[model samples]
Target: MTTDPQTLTWFKSSYSGNGGSCVEWAPMQATVTGIVPVRDSKAPNGPVLSVPSRSFAEFIAGVKGGAFSAT
Candidate 1:
């Protein structure tokens, strides 16, 4: 499904804690389409990164599991 990114509502995680470096995602769009739209919260009109739902879920899991740790 195709959608205008501008029309979709975007939101950041509460864990973001007011940091300007947070990333935002459109959950409604993700629900409608299998694609997850991600973008920098600092730039609302900036380019969006479209990730497959399964891949996105895996990435989130990895984050929760600390797979992407800087250490």
Candidate 2:
């Protein structure tokens, strides 16, 4: 499935703070669909990752839970 590219309002994670990690996502878009689109904040026209709604939720949970830094 696809969406109107011009209408997407993407925002970077609040956790990103002042760093240049540059990750962006459209939460409003995900609310309208069952998928979440994520991409580089610096590359609006670049590749995007479309993840299922549930998976996106889990990803956020993991981030909040600090799963990525436990390795």
Candidate 3:
């Protein structure tokens, strides 16, 4: 499914730290496609990662659970 980048309502995850390093995603779009499109907010026109919705959920759960230690 082709999606117009401009139409995507990209939003950063609440888990994102205040630091500059962060990723943004479009939740509404993900629900429809079963794929979550994510990109670096600092580079709006940059490449995007389209992951399976289930995988995205696992990733978020890991983040919230602090499975990955802060560097």
Candidate 4:
């Protein structure tokens, strides 16, 4: 299913604070289509990355586990 990016409500993590290097996601759209629409917070009009719900969940889990940590 296709959705207009402009129509979706995008939000960034509270931890983002005032930093411009953050990512935004459309939770409502994800709930409706099972696809997580992600985009750079600095570029609201830029391209969006559509990730599968399962893949997104795994990515989040890995993040929580520090699998992608820089340290």
Candidate 5:
């Protein structure tokens, strides 16, 4: 099934405490499609990244697990 990129809904994470370095994702779109559409919150008109649902999930898990270092 094909989905319209323009119709996708987007939202930022609660953990993204008003930081300039925040990204938004279309969870509703991901539910309808297997791909998660992500984009920089600071630049909504900028390029978007479509990641696979499973991969996005893993990335989120890694973030929560602190697998990535701020430094």
Candidate 6:
């Protein structure tokens, strides 16, 4: 389930350029609820995907560790 984006502060990696292919997350809410809110940077008002904190963290770690291949 998703929540009102207006009530949350969203952010993406600063290292990520403004290529419009980035993902934004609401860290504030995650700290309180242990659920991560993810949304497309290209569509702020679009649907938000809520993921469990542990799962989200593992996914991020996988990304950083290059566990996924772009191809």
Best candidate, TM-score-wise?
Answer: 4
Segments of candidate 3 deviating more than 4 angstroms: 15-18
**Residues 25-62, candidate 5, lDDT per residue (tens digit)?**
99988887788999998888778899999999999999
What lDDT does each candidate get? Answer: 0.88, 0.83, 0.87, 0.91, 0.85, 0.90
Query: Per-residue alpha-carbon lDDT of model 6 for 1-71, expressed as tens digits?
Result: 55588789999988779788999999989998899999999999898999999999999899999999989
Show where candidate 6 strays beyond 4 Å: none
On lDDT, who's better, 4 or 6?
A: 4
Q: Candidate 2: what lDDT?
A: 0.83
Give lDDT: candidate 2, residue 18.
69
Worst 10 residues of 1 by lDDT: 1-10
The positional error of residue 64 in candidate 2, measured at the CA in angstroms, is: 0.8
List where candidate 1 sits over 4 angstroms from the true fold.
Answer: none
Native-to-model Cα distance after best TM-score fit, residue 23 in candidate 4, in Å: 0.2
lDDT of 1: 0.88
Alpha-carbon RMSD of each model:
1.5, 1.8, 1.7, 1.2, 1.9, 1.3
Expressed as tens digits, the lDDT of each residue in 1-71 for candidate 3 is 37976689999867678896889999888989898989998889988888899999998799789999989
- lDDT, model 3, position 62: 100
* Alpha-carbon TM-score of each model against the true structure: 0.89, 0.83, 0.85, 0.91, 0.86, 0.90
lDDT by residue (tens digit), candidate 2, 1-71: 39864578989866787667788888888899988988887778887888998999998899889889856
Ten residues in a row with the worst lDDT in model 4? Answer: 1-10
Candidate 6 local Cα displacement, residue 27, angstroms: 0.6
Candidate 5 or 4, higher lDDT: 4
Error of 2 at 49 (Å): 1.0
